[model samples]
Target: MKPSFRLLSTVAAAALVCCASSSVLAQSKFVLKLAHADSADLGTSRKAVMADTFAKEVKAKSGGRIDVQIFGAGALGGEREVVEGVKNGFIQAGLASGVMANFFPGAMVTDIPYLFPSDEVADKVMDGPFGQKLSADFNAATGMHNLCFGEVGFRHFSSGKKPIHSPKDLVGMKIRVQETPLYVTEMKALGAQPTPIAFPETYTALQTGVVDGQENPIPTLIFAKFYEVQKNVTLDGHNYGIDWFVLSDKFYKSLPPDLLKVVTDAGKVACAEERKVNRTFTANGNKTMADKGVTVYTPTAAELAEFRAAAQPPVIEFLKTKIDPKLIDSIQTAVKDADAKK
Candidate 1:
């Protein structure tokens, strides 16, 4: 009563095909959420635009194996809250700013005023070995991954008072600063009464005279409508404000090898694209602010040097207490190397 060999072969082949189709149906897909502090519709918000780029790139690169859900305008929470969510696996990713120092004190390296000579240099270093090393250390310390540095462009001074020409002008002025000790120290060193204020509260703080001035990159100043409340904006480019895209160690490691590669690749592409957006907005942002009646000041070389000289030394000393000098030396070396190519 044995079956024919051809019949047996056909039955086995059908069973194998069924199993293969079932396996395909049962394969797991990943869903990741990215949180940031601005509205998705805010064209000038680099984080928002960057999240869009990352989401599209990751989805395309993963071939529907991954889905990125973006919660902007602090829908998930503030920068610190979002970072904490990433750290604890409550959220998968976030766009975090200097507040990252809360978890990795070494992040203070980014806070040094006048750090990166140019956006190009910052990109070269942050995407290179030094940034990778720092990012690795951050991952090891806090169970989170710093995917890459996205741009916040260069910070400039703006005031309801007069235009800022030198540190002396900042003296006695009450300035709104990110509620971080590093910034408090830098503004104090520059002679402003550094008033730590929440980012959401800043515009109202300015309007009410709770603070006379604030500092942020050009596009931010304009989009945040600081231009409406402030008359003079200085173009000192005092600091290159580097923002980070972070992922949870748990979520990142959970990805299969091929998917992990796709995510990492998407990170680099998205970061570069965000930098382009920041650069474009910043280049023409001065004119935008001027159109809003903001008096823009471009300092002479001597005037800028005065501001940088007065601002750097003490902050370098302050950073020494928080970060190793060797790491700082490493950053400067990377910058010099990046610049040497010019």
Candidate 2:
């Protein structure tokens, strides 16, 4: 059975009392409630691994002074709601994907279609100085502290009908997209009629022919069982999906200096582990999807270049109006710097 928050609070209070009674009054154990939208059964989902790793590492590093409680499968709420919970201090931390960018538009820069050339490029940019600055900017704007950046990999198109080999294939097709302007505009630019739908409702949308296809990372495509409904999977790799580790400023500041360090350091460790697992899963996930009767397609280099060029202008134009031009320039410079090191 899941442990109740009341019970955990009571236990924490009792631990504090015990410490108070001791002559030395050692640091008492503190409990942090972490929430994410994915189910525990998805082995490749970074959120599950992150929760497990963060809890284990923080406990080990803090010498049992910090306890982390994980609530997965939207048991807490959706990404937007979870972000709100963290902001209000109702929850200590959240594991959210690009949806969180809705609250911090500066993050929208990462969602620019075709900006990342490859997975290696994405890693270099996100794990380097640019990523750190974006995290800091997000925290400052939202009043929440961002601990680390983790990847969900690049998203690709999956459909129940014909294979998507080029931008023209997407023409007149109704593609499901997250309710984000970046996604909608990109899809429209590529010739598909973008349909914004909540994630939980996507399967039915596909089943009822409400949408012709949807795009997602391989792990998410597999975990969501999209392979069951979709006959074709295309590795268009239009956008790099990113996940952020966000902590409540209130909760973070409440911790002792050493404990705070433990949380931050543990985040970095968890990010490394999660990135390794995600990379390996992405490599094999296509084969796994194909085995399940989904026809997988990888565009040739020239074809991919054409796709990238076609999808770039609309997103760039859209961003020019929505986000600061200087912030956009800074992001471009950061990507260039990351590439230079490689």
* Per-candidate local distance difference test: 0.86, 0.86
lDDT (10s digit) by residue, model 1, range 8-44 = 9999999999999988756658889989977677476
RMSD of each: 2.4, 8.8
How many Å off is the CA of 250 in candidate 1?
2.0
The TM-scores of all predictions, comma-separated, are 0.91, 0.88
TM accuracy, model 1: 0.91
lDDT of 2 by residue, 1-342 (tens): 356988998999999988778834344568899999876654766778878899899989988878799999899998888999999999999989867767888888888887787777788888777888888888889999889888888899999989999999999999999887888889989999999998889999998899999999888887788888999999978988788899998899889888999999999888778888888788788888868988998899888987888888889889988778787888788777767777
Per-candidate clash tally: 0, 0
Shift of residue 263 alpha carbon in model 1, Å:
1.0
